[model samples]
Target: MVNYRYLGNSGLKITELTYGNWITHASQVENAQATACVRAALDVGITSFDTADVYANTAAEEVLGEALKGERRESLEIFTKVFWPTGPGGANDMGLSRKHIMESIHGSLRRLQTDYVDLYQAHRYDYDTPLEETMSAFADLVHSGKVHYIGVSEWTADQIRAGAALAKELRIPFVSSQPQYSMLWRVIEDEVVPASREVGVSQIVWSPVAQGILTGKYKPGQAPPAGSRATDEKSGAKFIERFMREDILTRVQHLRPIADELGLTMAQLAIAWVLQNSNVAAAIIGASRPEQVRDNAKASGVEIPAELMTRIDEVLGDVVERDPARTVEAGPRSR
Candidate 1:
């Protein structure tokens, strides 16, 4: 079973390994497969789920809702995000503006088949909308019982500081952050982690496997295995492209002995690596098959030793992306 961690300083405790449906829920797999994956997560004691309204253009939430239908709602932590175009790309369809946030929550609730989500997150910081407007709208949702807690995904350190200050003023729970974190990607370490630690916010990291590159299945100089995320152009191939270079793959192969020593698969080693961060409350894992969920869930309780941790850094040395500026560069400049 997966262990639990408190999100930030809050009373709520979530599974250390959260099951997120970013690309696999409705877009990459059939409904039956998606539901089975959710079941596998449940069977392994994962109670936290993460999703976004813009995933599969909103069908993902519906599928997740149906899959978790008979489970006890209070026993689960359901998180969803706003700030992307869902339902047609209209001018009013995206961003963290008051109008979009307000409308998007209602649609998310209706599709998720729940009265309130455990955590409602801003998918990204909206460059065009005033932060006050966005936080105030989120405050309204908390007041109305539509959302239990608030979070943001991929916001910069300064942005998190500003938002945490406003959240304190509004008296709403601003408790979590979701960022792309993995062995190969350490963009959040320098700035975001420190800022979040100061503000009582914990990280719910995504892509701990670097979109499956850390799994050690993608060879150094060969075509990606058929049906892999690297080949699935519609779902996540573009995201994995950054790490598909021969040099990166060759360096990744160096970590196999480390995994062998630990008796963990490369994927498990990668996921365990991120959870070693004290600020990370949870690492979100997505899966297309039920067994993938089961396999990755084993990473939850494994503790990588200090020397091996150091050696991992030594092995992946220059391949790691540790720049804090990449956080800003990765986010959108305009709504």
Candidate 2:
């Protein structure tokens, strides 16, 4: 069964495993397939669903809305993000600016077919917008009842600290931090995790399987499988290239014995490793098939022995990317 965790210090409870539609829902798969995957997630007891306004040019949100049309709205936590271009070409089309945020929330609500989103996040820090302006805008959204809690994704420790300070002054709940965290990507542990813990923000991590590399599907010195993400022409292949090296693939092969010993699949071991961190409130998984959701949801309540966890670190040493400075930021839009 999927267990729940308090989002940071907030009373809001979310499933430890969150089903997200990022690059899949409206882009790579059919509506029926996407709906099937969502149904599979729900059937497996996942109550938290995540999406973004910019995914597939805003089609992902609409697809998710249709999938959850008849469910009790209060029984689920629906999270969406703003801060990439989601509208027609214009200076005000993106970022965390009050104008864009205000405009984006309503567009999100309409597309989602919901009266309010449970957790609204800044998809990325808006370097072009002042922190106060962005915080004040989010504060207004919370006060207006359109959004319940606020969070940020892929932000640096410094960025999270600055935002948390303003969120405190505004008396708004900054309850979650979403980062790319996994057994291979330890970037969040050094800085983001510490900062978020200090500021009362739990992590809702993404790419917990390192884009499926940790699944041990891609073998070293072999061409990617026919339908695997590494073979996708659009975006998957590119997004997963960082961990596609032979060194990484070879080291990943060594995990099979550990997984076999624990009676868990490679994917489940990966997700369970991330959940071992107390600060990780949830780990987001994206699936294109209903079976994938069923398989991943089993990772929710798993616990890895400490000795095995340490062995995983030793086996994956050096290949792991732990630099806190690797946190990314987007450049201002060039008009």
Candidate 3:
């Protein structure tokens, strides 16, 4: 069985290693392919799935909901995010406006074929909508049983504080934050992780594989692998140029020996490294096949020794990926 951790301040505990859908959902891949990926994830003890409303133009949820059309729903925690344009019709179509949250939650339920989401999230910060409006709407969802818990994705330190303060006054459950965090992405480590730790919020990390960069599938002086997401037009491969610096590549290259010594894949070692951090409530993984999820699941029980941690820091250096620049100056995480 997968190891579980309580998500932030919420009593709800989920497997520390969870499944997430990005390109895997939506129209980017076939529904049959998506179903296979999810089944593989579940078979390996993944009990949570994180998806966004706008992923694959909202069709991803419909697909997932359909795939979960049996007893499969009983044992799983389904999470879906909002805050993007669902389509081209209304003024209330995007962001965290009260009208959008109110409408979108119902829409998501319809697509998900569920009564309530285990966790409903703000997919990203909404500068246009006031935090009060967003919090009040979320509180209504929690009160009315439309959502079990609440979370925010990709929010900065100030945004989390503002939302948490409002949720506290409203007595609504604000439990977790979803951000791009991984062995290659330490941007959150500098400040965001510390802020979440302080506010008693749990972190459900997305892209735990660093978009497959840290898996050793991509390397310096190597051609992009055939049929890899990095080769796709819509994939987020363009941003990796900054991460592909020679010094960083050298550091990544140094990790191969460690994985080899342990008789594990680089991806497994990369995942094991993240789970060693106590602040991480869960690491959300994306998989296109059963093998990928199975491979990731194996990493759950692999313990990283203190010497390996020291070696990692020394070799990987200070470079880590994030939605923004790794420019934040803050103290290291207190474990």
Q: Could you say which candidate leads in lDDT? A: 1
Q: Using alpha carbons, what is the TM-score of model 3?
A: 0.92
Sorting all predicted structures by TM-score, with the top scorer first, yields: 1, 2, 3
RMSD of 1: 0.7
For residues 1-335, could you state the per-residue lDDT of candidate 2 as single tens digits? 78999999999999999999999999999999999999999999999999999999999999999999999999999999999998787989988889999999998999999999999999988878898999999999999999999999988899999999999999999999899998888888988999999999999999999999999999999999998999998979988999999999999999989999889999999999999999999999999999999999889889899999989998998999988877863234331
lDDT of 3 by residue, 107-197 (tens): 8999989999999998888777778999999999999998999998878877788899999999988889888777888767767778888
Q: Candidate 2: misplaced stretches above 4 Å?
A: 329-335
Q: State the number of backbone clashes in model 2.
A: 0
Residue pairs clashing in model 2 are none
Put down candidate 1 lDDT per residue, 1-335, tens digits, no spaces: 99999999899999999999988888889999999999999999999999999999999999999999999999999999999899678899989999999999999999999999999999999989999999999999999999999999999999999999999999999999999999999999999999999999999999999999999999988999999999988868999999999989999999999999999999999999999999999999999889999999989889899999999999999989999888887668996
CA lDDT of each prediction against the hidden true structure: 0.95, 0.93, 0.81
Better of 2 and 3 by lDDT: 2
Question: How many steric clashes does model 1 contain?
Answer: 0
Poorly placed runs, candidate 1 (over 4 Å): none
User: TM per model?
Assistant: 0.99, 0.98, 0.92
Kindly indicate the candidate among 2 and 3 with the higher TM-score. Answer: 2
True-structure RMSD, every candidate: 0.7, 1.2, 4.3
